[model samples]
Target: MVEESAPDRTTVATVTRNTASTITAKFQADNSEPVENKNTWGYVNVTEVTDALQDTAAHDVCAPFNAPVPNYRAPHRRTIQVKCYEYIWLIKYREQTILKNEACKRHRLNLPKDVNPPSGERYTYQGEFPHMGIIGWKDKEGDYIFMCAGSLISAKFVITAAHCTNLRDPSVEKPTPDIVRFGDRSIVPEAADAEFTVESKIHRIIIHPVPNYRELYRFRLTE
Candidate 1:
């Protein structure tokens, strides 16, 4: 009890320096009394503590696992091609200036300059021509009068008016005309080509059910 153990010589300088500074030594008291200056017992680096606290705050703020990442391509726009034939037709029709002027004036359509109108002169018939013929019955004087217009329907069968056959009384005993003209513009009865002569008698007649008499008259009048 009289002699105290020697203090660590190595820690003596450190203890002396700590005592000389504002820092103090601390030790636990007997009988569990409160220790004096217990907070200063161990060496603490303030810089290291501050650095660890800053790193923990940065990791909490970033929150790396909480949110999903965005797709770079999701917001992009696209274009599509389309074909438009009816729109092209409308554009072409709208651009004709002459047609536009006519519409504005409320006038009937003016024919284009290149088309030639039919001449007023009647086509007189001469004897014995080809392809051209008058479509009518023969009079008592053996002359063909005009009935309705006709074109050659076939070689053997001359297509003419149903009225042409029906107009005359059935009591008249004469056969229908066997002659057909070829290549002649005048309305004349003449011998046809060999094929026409061979096939001429087998004619088929077709009449429209609703004969538009006004249109037929207009066509004949114009001709």
Candidate 2:
């Protein structure tokens, strides 16, 4: 096999400083500067200029701040680009601290659990499923229909799907049926053995701004 020769290096014009004035100056004017300074600045060697050029070229080709000590290779090179608008919100809200230490201390001290006993009944279960219970309802024809599924998130608020009680269409005559079921494995009304009257005073309905309508119906009917 023939021996391969190393790639020939090409000499590229390199600049030690990149000031706009130096870049825009004519080549003749730039070369004349050192010559004019020779008498005033003492004996000027052309080799010194060549050495400076080589030094600048070497610096440009070498890795910055010295190579890694362990000789590991980087998977990729990092490029940094910044946008002013991206940090505008963060800068504007920098001083706003909603959860101050004093407020946090007060909130921890006055936590709801320590204030009162859970208003609704509680149950324990064995298995991987959630321990919370839900209430179911029946239709006029006595067919089992799921009204809502609520968890005792707090003493006053029962967390359930908002679609259960809301109107699908305002023009429709009837709103979605309201039935609450507790301790039931399936949507069958007969399956529910215990029941509780919804305290209208404490009962509330809240619709999420981005509610998944398709999943909402399924959650209300099931868990």
Q: Which candidate gets the maximum lDDT versus the true structure?
A: 2
lDDT per residue, candidate 2, 1-223, as tens digits?
Answer: 9998865443222332344336435543655432222223233233433332343334322122121112112222112111222233233222122122223323434544344323883222212133344533334565545545666554444465556556454433346544444444334333232332222222334556677654332222222
Which regions in candidate 1 have their CA more than 4 angstroms from the true location? 1-132, 153-180, 188-204, 211-223
- The per-prediction tally of clashing pairs is 12, 6
lDDT of 1 by residue, 187-208 (tens): 3233222233211222333345
What's the C-alpha lDDT at position 172 in model 2?
37
lDDT at 45, model 1: 27
List pairs with backbone clashes in candidate 2: 134-181, 135-180, 135-181, 135-182, 136-180, 136-181
* Model 2 / residue 24 / CA error / Å: 99
Q: Please, what is the whole-model Cα lDDT of each candidate in the order they appear?
A: 0.35, 0.36
**Candidate 2 ranges beyond 4 A from true positions:** 1-131, 135-138, 141-144, 167-173, 195-202, 209-223
lDDT, candidate 1, at 117? 27
For the record, the alpha-carbon RMSD of candidate 2 to the native fold, in angstroms, is 24.3
